[model samples]
Target chain A: MLEVRDIHTYYGDSYILQGVSLRVEAGQVVALLGRNGAGKTTTINSIVGLVPPRRGEIVFKGETITRAPPHHIARLGMGLVPQGRRLFPNLTVEENITLAARTGNGSARWTLDAVYALFPRLKERAHNRASQLSGGEQQMVAIARALMTNPDLLLLDEPSEGLAPLLVREIGRVLADLKAQGLSFLLVEQNLHMATAVADWVYVMNKGQIVFEGTPQELLGNEEIKHRYLGV
Target chain B: METLIIQLLNGLVFSMLLFTMAAGLSLIFGQMDVINLAHGSFYLLGGYIGLTMVRRLGSFWLALVVAPLVVGALGLALEYFFLRRLYGRHRHLDQVLFTFGLALIAADLIRWNWGAYVESVPPPELLSGQIPVFTVQFPVYRLSLIAVGVTLALGLGLLLERTRIGAIIRAGVADAEMVSALGIDIHKVFAGVFALGVALAALAGVLGAPVLNLYPGLDFEILILTLVVVVVGGLGTLRGAFFGSLLIGMADTFGKAFLPEFALFLIFAVMAVVLLLRPSGLFGLEGT
Candidate 1:
């Protein structure tokens, strides 16, 4: 479980996240829906300590990690699938996964074998450089890489950004399967349909604050609110 | 024919020395993005330390082993005290200014301790004799220097290309923040790499002492030449360093043999041509 309470983050003099609060219970898929510049990516970044909140409290599991560095936060079981997938272009698929591997996550830890089983396309291209992989394959490698860290909470920033429709559906299936395996995910997405397909609890963010929190069904039934807040 | 053969051998020997001298400089710049203008000073310090060790222990082998460690420790100290604070500042000017100043202080210290004298330590006894190559005799010491440098280059090539740590270093070169995000202590990697670079510089000093000789102003000369090597080879690649050193070494050696008046200008001329042709040097990533 992760809880971010009333956090304000900034980039120099420009204020970004303004007193935003959200939470995800254990093993739940929490989709943060927002338009561009709505501070969804900034929210995830603040949680992972890439951009430390100017004033806020972030609790992971139980302990406060608001002031911890990014590496320390990563070590404490927060895996990030950065925007653009950010795979080391020069590294082979295996090398990219192994670099992010953290041992002793628990009995159900995700090993290279486990990840390879999940994404067989990556295994075929194990020796190939990440740059050689297609976009969908690169996104798979990114998720597998984060999984290799055996993180309790995975933060994804815009997973469906540049994917084809078929690939987006495939990614949704993967997330749904992972949720069934008791994994937690905080997905930052602009695609309303993909967010609704996988997420249990939906939170709509507007101008750096969470404006709506409801079940996916509740969100889908409401059109006026979606048109006003999400421009959908 | 004999003169040509002799010059060819000399050029090869000098090329290898240049490779060894420039390797560490290129590596530190590649990994930490630090110019380390004080690297030549580290080389001078190593030679002086090796000379002192040989005089005291009466053993060239022991001096070779011990001197680099002392110089490497000094390098570690430099990183810990000075360079550690400057990571991610995006201003390399501070590093250039600080290290250039350090090089000056190092020269004064050497002059104060060694009395401004030019000295050349004798090669180890096994390498003291001459070996006939083709139509001419070459000093065994120079031949050994080539062997040492080539062996080092091969070893370094393996280290960067094949191993896991090498993969990490290569990845770090591409994106250091991602490397840190993967839970790696990137600062530790930087410190160790800086120390390794320092050790290589000291090794060059100890091994090259007989060939290059030792003096206070030697630092500036070597530093400028090494800068030429890094710039001409490409700023952040081993291939650039190797090829750059090779070209400069051959040019310097052959220029002296055939046209003594143009020897000094030949190195810069080669650099000018390479830059005009490639802009990023011989091995630099294009448009980088």
Candidate 2:
């Protein structure tokens, strides 16, 4: 479980997250929906310690992790699939996945075999350079790289960005399967349909603040909230 | 043919020495993006340390081991105290200025301790004789230098390209933030690699002491040579450093043998042309 409490984050004097709060229980898939500049990435970044919150506390599995360094937080069982799929372009696919491979978190760990099983295409291109892979394949490698860490909680920032609609559906299905297997995710997305399809609880963010929190059906049913906040 | 062979051997000997120094400088440059102007100072300091150890212990082997370790410890302290603070906060000319200051101080310290007079260490008795090579004879120590340099090149190449830690370092070289996000303590890697880089430079300094003699201005002399080698090789990888050292070494050697007057100018001209053609240098990756 992860708890981010009223965290105000800033990039220099420009305030990004003005008192944002959220929570994800174990095994829950929480989606944050907003248009551009909604501070979704900043929230995930704050939690990951890349951009530490200017003022707030983040607790991961009952421990305060707001001020921990990014690497330390990652070592504490929190994984981040960062935006832009920052893969080592020159490293082979196998090297990319295994370079960050930590010992698994729980009893049933995610191994290279498990990740390969999830994305068979990755196994086929094991020796190819990461830059040679297609966007969808690169996205899969990103997810697999995170899973290699065996994180108790995974934060995905725009996993479906720049993907085809079919690829987006495939990503959603991959998340659905992972959710069934009891992986907690804090997903930041612009796609409402995909967000709703996979997320258990949805939070609508606007202007660096969380404005609405409800179930998937509740979020879809409320057109006023959707139109006003998420710009749907 | 005999004259050509002699010049080529001379070039190879000098190339090995330059490679030993440039390999470390290139790796440190790639990893930290810090132009450690003080790097050659490590060589000067290590030569003095080796001189002292060789005299007191009466063993070239012991001096060889001890001098680099002493210089490496000093380098580690320098990183922890001074250079460590500069990371992220200081990127450009400030780092150069700081390391440049260190180089100055190191030169002064060497002068103060060892005096301004040039000093030299004799090659070990076992390697003091000459060995026949084709038509001419070569000093056993010079051949030893070639052997040492070749072994180091292979060993370092394997360690960087084959191991998991090497994979992490190579990846970090490509993208640092992602490596950190993967739970790698990148700062530690920087420190470790920096230390190794300095240690190797010091080791080369100790090894080359007999070949080039020990002097206060030696730091500045080799610093220029190392910088030229790193630039000509490329910027990021060990392979680049090795090739760069060879190219520059051969150019300098043959240039000197045939055209002693214009050798330096010609070498610079060749280097400028190489950069103009391939800005990344031979075997170097882009973006430093």
Which candidate should be chosen as best, given DockQ against the real structure?
2
User: What is the lDDT of every predicted structure here?
Assistant: 0.86, 0.89
Clashing pairs in 1: B233-B240
Off by over 4 Å in 1: A105-108, B285-288
* Tens digits of lDDT, candidate 1, A1-232: 8999999999778898999999988889999998899999889888988788999899998989998877788888888998889888878999898886887446647999999999998999999999899999999999998998888899999989899999999998898889999999999999999999999899998888888889999998999769978897
Pairs of residues at least 3 apart in sequence or in different chains that clash in candidate 2: none
Worst 10 residues of 2 chain A by lDDT: A101-110
List runs of model 2 lying over 4 Å from the truth.
Answer: A104-108, A228-231
Model 1 docking grade: medium
